[model samples]
Target chain A: MKTYLPPKSTLIVWQIRVTVLLALLVAVLYWFIADYFLVLFCVSLVLAVVFNLIYFPAFLRCYSISVNQNAIIIKSGVFIKHERILPFPRMIYAEKQQTLVAKAFSVSALVLRVARAATLTVELKDNDIAEIMKAVAKWQ
Target chain B: MAVKLKITAHPIMIFYYLKPFWFVLIIPLIKAIVSAVIKAEVNNVLLNELFISVVLITYSVIKWKKLKINISSDFIEIYLGVVRRRYANIPINKISTIETTKSPLDYIFGTQKVKINTEAGKQGSADFWFKLNVGDVKKVTELYPEKVTPKTIKFSAVRVAVMAATSSSAFTGIVLVVPIINQAVRLLGTAVTDLLLDRINKIGQLFSKFMPPVVNTVTVVFLISYFIAFLISFFKSVNFKVVFAGKKTGVFSGLLVLRKVLFNTKSVNSVCIEQTPLMRFFARYLLRVGIGGYGNRKGDRAVVVPSAKRDEVHELFSVLFPKFEPADNKIKPHKNTRWRFYYLPTLFLAVSVILYLVLSYSFPVFKGLISFGFIVTACVLAYYYSLAEYNTKHSCISVAPVIYANYTRWSATREMFCEHNRIGIIHITRWPVDKRKNTCNVRLTVRSEAAESITVKHISYNELTDEIKSLYQI
Candidate 1:
């Protein structure tokens, strides 16, 4: 059995994505209500800093993917912990998906398509994505 | 025997073909009527509607004529489109489910609706849907391979009637009645509907001395609706039968409009035995199986048995899938966490009592009625909560190559049997409260075209991890 932890670059990418989303939200609010633009901007900045510096790292630490000959087990969630297991025989196919932002960070998302319209997705480094795909293909 | 390779859909296809464009087609007719009413152009309006009707009919006829299907040894080819002329060739072995249903409209037209589902397309909608003549439908079904056997089972009318009564609920009855009542009001016009409402009001007023008129009227309507729903269920379950051929299972039933569905037994993902609180009391069960490419909506999964006694259900299940059986060993919830089951209901009872005290004082005239109603509601809720607790205590799970779970969902209890290979995901969740209690919830989802899940609640956290570790060595 091999356990893979997401690279720190993936975490950085996610933090950047969140910061962009917060900036967009504040811009939208400023367009609608100019009176409170400064306050909204300050709140958004604090939220982004707190979330990226504290919450995201804790979340990344908790999330992991373990692959064995039998199944792929995912352990995730911060406060309300969740452990999900997907057996290999139930897997239909696997594919790699990379967005422009993730590509810039050398990170990509691996999607495992299983039966019954269920999908499991996780972000990993390019080498890790290749290794996982090879392992899944061998099982198939 | 020589088989026909090329086939055309029945005339009933016109209805399906026009369904999507009905709104667009009606707008012109409505415009014509409005113009005629305002401008007194009756002659022109008649001519316009006639022309529009002729064009629509001609379009549907031409489209129907152009649409054709060719069934080859290894593939099915469908020729579609009026001007573009597109074709799709689906491999025969890739077909997942073959469903044939006859709605009331199809019955009137002497046709059957066929939906061919494959895993390639959208989740809820079928890949290929067309209406065919009864003879053509038989020919189509023949093209699919099947190994016929002698095993068969039939559901009797008496069992179906009992099942209908036990499974029927007021909510379903109300949903089925609302449309019919709306249509009736439209047909009867304002004056007749007003008279009916006035009579109902008077009846309610006549009972005002005893209780609130609204309550009286609602109770009567609810009872009537429930009875109507029960009758509908009975009719739907009439003449239910199942035939188990070697690799294929065929189900045939329906009252006014006969329905037929054929499934590849190997493609079946899971078997579910469902029982409502009432059915539990009567020791009855409804058996259903989840098959690939089958819709997930209510009444979509193939019903192996509509309703049956406990022993009969077991017998049928053993015959259908001899290798798999319901789990016997039970894992009751820990004694420490058992009180969580009654927490919500006890809170509700307390609130109801407080409300009674406050409302009785404010409304002196209706005090007796309020007290009686609240007390009855409290008693029923208490009874329901006790039953739920009993069910929770009995919930069991087995983690093996094939998982078996019997768990309570809301007020209904469902027993799920599924193979490990067919399981999509096993999720063990620990909420904030559950973390404090040292318990967790386990959810198992079966793999099919649609998602079907079974959840077990309030189990010891250590026990769950141990079970998962034993099964998958996680």
Candidate 2:
């Protein structure tokens, strides 16, 4: 079975943007309630950085999706792994969505909708969308 | 063949609008009563109420005349709405279910309100009523002549009452009332609260003096609430029956308002058999089916049997899914997850002990009593947790042409059976601790628009994954 992963640069950029946003929010709070919030915010920021550093590698390694004859297999985890096997026949629809950041990075997200279940989303290069769509079309 | 059936100038439609007319006249009726009581002048007030009633009647009559219904070979078209002129064209094949409701007025007038539900239609479902002699229902069914000969199962009034008494609806009522009671207590001043508590304690003491051991106000309240819950449940599920026809399953239930629901068996995503703690003692189970568009306001599932014995459930399942035998395959969760069951209760017990010791210093008089109560509560909690653990250990999933899963949620045990291909998605979740323990939770969702899902917790992760892969041929 072949494996697919999201672009590493996109993940890193998204994480940095999120971290910067949180830091800005914390800095604004420090200006108002600076007594213990400063220490709390600093600790939280350090923990977030450490967490991302540890999690990103595991996420890249564990997060893999593949489509076979019968089903679509998605494996993802940081500390705990989850492997979902969604049958193609049961899928209601497949949607391709691209966020502004993802569009800039030339990566798109593919979501497969199944009834009454959590949709499976795979972030990959825009080129892969056609292949995935073809695969889903064949099954349907 | 095209068949045109227009619903217009029907007296039944007048009865349908009667409630709204009555609702509109409530203020006028109250005014008339007040005038009679105050000034002994009822003529003017009565005239005003009569005028309002006449206007409402005229409006209903106008609305009734504007409605048009056409039943064709391929589609059922409904044209109504005076100004906007709303038109709904529902295909015959897409019609999921047809629900009929009959009130006392319907019985008197020999009419029934029919709601035609289609698969996720834009208008939800088309609702209209016509003359009973019209045979509109037969005309609709004739479009799809391919029928399955259904086996009918009717429950006795006694059985229905018992089922109702043990239903979760009663528990829901009790749950609803608790918040209201708490709010009332809060709104009432401390003086009233103290007085009420004292009176309750006195009553408890009186009962205790006659009976052995000490009884408290809490115990009395609990007993009273339980009785109230039983009464509520009994009333909710008074008359219930299941009719299994070829291709369609009809559930006829309700006490004050008779509801008859006919749903296509092909649309049913899954069948669920639930047994609460009280139900276990009675050996009765509640059966419900998950369909895409047919559901109550509270839940997206329809009850086939509100309560039934083991044999009855087996009989029903035999007809519903002939290829799958529920008793043939039973797969249990791993035994290693027993520790997970006892963990929360043990933690709660420890916390209670610490709190009791700390609080004892403030209210020293009831120290011994509080400690005794805490110990008793802990023991009960431990016992219930053990039962829950046992139920979890017995949870299993069987896969064939159909998938049957037996799992426990809180104190209730549920057994669900569905077509393997109908399953929307399969999810396996594991926390960091669960990963280390090699145990995870598996959730199988049915392909329905409704929020119908089943989860089996603390099962061996690898074993379940391998089983699913092999069974589904993934």
Candidate 3:
């Protein structure tokens, strides 16, 4: 089995956009409070570099996700690598969360709660959730 | 638990009598007498004494009017207060513990206080200390047993009897001796007063007139306090009794005004045998029960055990809770964090003391020495406690999906039971040093009695990983 992008990419994007907006607003507020807040422009650049350090590779790995017949495994965590496996039969519920920005971006969530209560979530197009949910149900 | 088995918790009748009644009244009266003597006024002495007596008598009468208690097989009910009568009726099933307390004071007066607590709700018990008129506690404990007390309970009755007699002697002697100590202290005060006669006379004059013989004021307020304390003590001692009355499966026990309480051996989560440093030196121990709920979680003062001798432990426990074994071997926890040398509790104290001495002008030498001594003592004590904890901890799986972690730290062992299903999430944090050592720490999130998630620490990195996978069956 191959795990696709999460069915809630649009929702995740909306959340990220909102977060970014909040950060920008805070930066503006800091600028109003202290003139030296402009130095944080450099800090944000450094932060963006740090984010991409993990996120870029993780995104690539996520696209290439594959697993055995029983489970779809996602390998992550740099120092303590975790191989999270979601067994199809143990999948109890699945959902997609979408925010306005994510809807505009056409991204949604493919969220699944396994019998063990471990949450397996992947960001993807909203269309992927129903298909994935149906396929997992049929497989189970 | 037979249908015919009737039980009762005797009413605490002593609340009607003045508590340390005379001890409370006498101090102000004495101060007034002393003032009157110094001033050479016989009328003032007589007036103060009469005023103190009136207050004591009025209090005793009010209490006598307020207290009423009764019990049947199903319930133990109490109606208290002459003014705003407060009523409480506890069903027999709600009773969680029946404790009989005897102080040195209780033994001297030939009385014991019976405290009965029930598990009606999560916060389901109150201690009602009553001087038992008769001494059969077995009759009281039989009312509520997790099961009936089994007759097979091992008893060191000989040892228990000896200890009980010895303990009982000291309390009475102490009460009787209190007068001697009071007089001696008073004599010392008198000598000091004479030496500082001119100054003390002026001070006494200012204090004497202000001491209106009201029930709650005056520097001699402490006098009435002790009088009340003495009365409580005498009442607790008079009919002091605790019996190791063994029933079919549990032990039934209480002092004079009988109370039958039942505790299930299996139901108890942990038992804490404790003492302050002072009590530890005296070899005195207090046993406390810690169950799974939050209601009984935090308390330092517990019901006084009839005796502290180790030999009588079994007999007492048998009557209280038989399923619980004093030497339970099933669950013991391993010491993962034992490097006290790495922990800077002692160093911090020493450094702070040194800093205070160097920077502060007030009694610097005394503070330094005291702080240094305390730090050294605490370091040594903690090292020992950590070692003991290591030896006594072990974990076992008795109930499915529920693991019990038994820990003995600070001479008090507590067992924590956590269900695998109850774990919300696991967080593994690695400090810079830990990362170098490849030993990460695990935090398990559990919903405690308050229903909010509580994160518990100190599980090994490898063990946490193993537990995670084990919880999920393929």
Candidate 4:
């Protein structure tokens, strides 16, 4: 089974963005309360950084998507792992979508519309997206 | 056949436009007459009513004139709208269902409303009319002769009545009547309201004279609403039957307004056999089918069997889904995982206990009653959790070309069967605790915008994955 991982830099950028957002939230709370929330904010900031440092690497490592002749397997999550197998026949459509951040990072997301109600999104390099689409076409 | 055969709908459809505004017209007309009699100034009120009536009539006339239904060999095109000139071209093959409804007014006018429901979701059915004198329902049925012919199964009047009486639809009817009841109370005045309440209190006194006023009032309201609900349900499903012809299922029902509905069986997303608490005691089940395009956006699904015995349900299932089996090989969650079901309820009880302790300090008089209520709630929660655990244990998934899932919702258990090919997505979620326990929640979603999903919690993750891979050859 072949495996593909998202760009490592993209994960780092995402984590940095999340950390910044949390810092802004904490700053807003500090502005409002001006109490022992300063201590709580510091603790939260450290915990968030530590948790992200530990989880993001594991997530990057574990987050592998593989497309076979019949099914697309999405293996994700760090502590609690998820291995979703979406069969080709069951997939309604597959499209490559790029957000502003993803476009800046030169990465794209392959969104698979599965069965009636479920969708699976896997991040891939811009170049790899075309390859995945070709693979999907071949399977079809 | 001509290239394009254009025809105007029966003139009765003009009334369809006016039907919605009838109340608007009637309310003001009544007010105008009352004001005229009370205040001797009739000209302004009468003029206002006449002006509104004229505008409504003109609008309906314009709408009626513009509405044109063109029947081609391949498609049915509807052209209407005065300002926008809207055009709708529905392919004949894509037409999933055709329903005809006949109100008392329609019967008197020798006409009926024909609603053409295409495989379009949410947009709603396209309604026209059939002039009983000009064209019979046979003309529409003749267009799809092969699909329309089916073996009909008519429910007995007694059976229909029983089914309706036991249905939860009565509860919804009771909810609808609440506003009407309120309006009536307001219109009739407090004297009538007090009399009714007194009568209800007297009836409640018969049950338990020592009961609190609040409890007595609640009991009386419940009894009255339940009776009204029974009447509504009985009337709604008075004449119910299902006609199975090839791949199409025709449902004919209604009492005052007759409804003849037809839909393709292939479009059925899932079959749900639901039984309310009352029906559970009688061993009766209501079988409803969710259609794909329509989704489960309320009343979209057709009730093939409104109410039936266990054996009758089995027969209905066999007839509807001949290729699929309704029975399942049961799967049980690990005993250790039963904590998952009990965790939330136990936490709730703990929170309630803390609240009781805190609040009892302020209100000492109600402390004993509150404690008793809390204990009763805790006991009920414990019993409910036990039932939920049992439901999880019995819930099973089977694959035989089609997937059949047997699970419980609240106290009522249901068996849902859907084609494997129709399954859109299968989601398996595991929490950190579940990771350690090796148990996960599995959800099978069918293609419906309404998100019709079947979730089976606390199942062995490895077992389910292995089973799916082997069974589906994925």
Best by lDDT: 1
| lDDT comparing candidate 3 with the true structure | 0.45
Error of 2 at B357 (Å): 4.1
lDDT of each: 0.73, 0.67, 0.45, 0.68
Evaluate chain B of model 4: give its TM-score. Answer: 0.76
Give the per-residue Cα lDDT of candidate 3 at B157.
42
**For every candidate, how close is chain A to the native chain A in TM-score?**
0.94, 0.81, 0.66, 0.83
Which CAPRI category fits model 1? incorrect
Q: What is the lDDT of candidate 2?
A: 0.67
Question: Which candidate wins on TM-score?
Answer: 1
Cα lDDT tens digits, model 3, B4-45, are 322232333433364465465666677777887798877855
CAPRI category for model 4: incorrect
TM-score of 2: 0.61
Tens digit of per-residue lDDT, candidate 4, span B1-474: 243556677777677788888787956777787888898776976988878888888988898887777676766666666643444444554555677777777778777777765433342333333433235455656655664456888888887776776666565334434434443333333333344456787654443433344444554585687777787667767788888888878888889988887787766777888776557657788888876544223545778888889889988888777866643544457777866766776788788788878866775645555555566567657766755665646666765457777776666677788877767799989999889999888888876544467777787878888878876798
CA RMSD of all predictions: 12.4, 14.8, 20.5, 15.1
Q: What value of lDDT does candidate 4 attain over all alpha carbons?
A: 0.68
Cα miss at B145, model 4 (Å)?
2.3
Tens-digit lDDT string for candidate 1 (B138-223): 77777765666547889889877766766667434454344444433333333333444567877544444333444446556766
Better candidate by TM-score, 1 or 2: 1
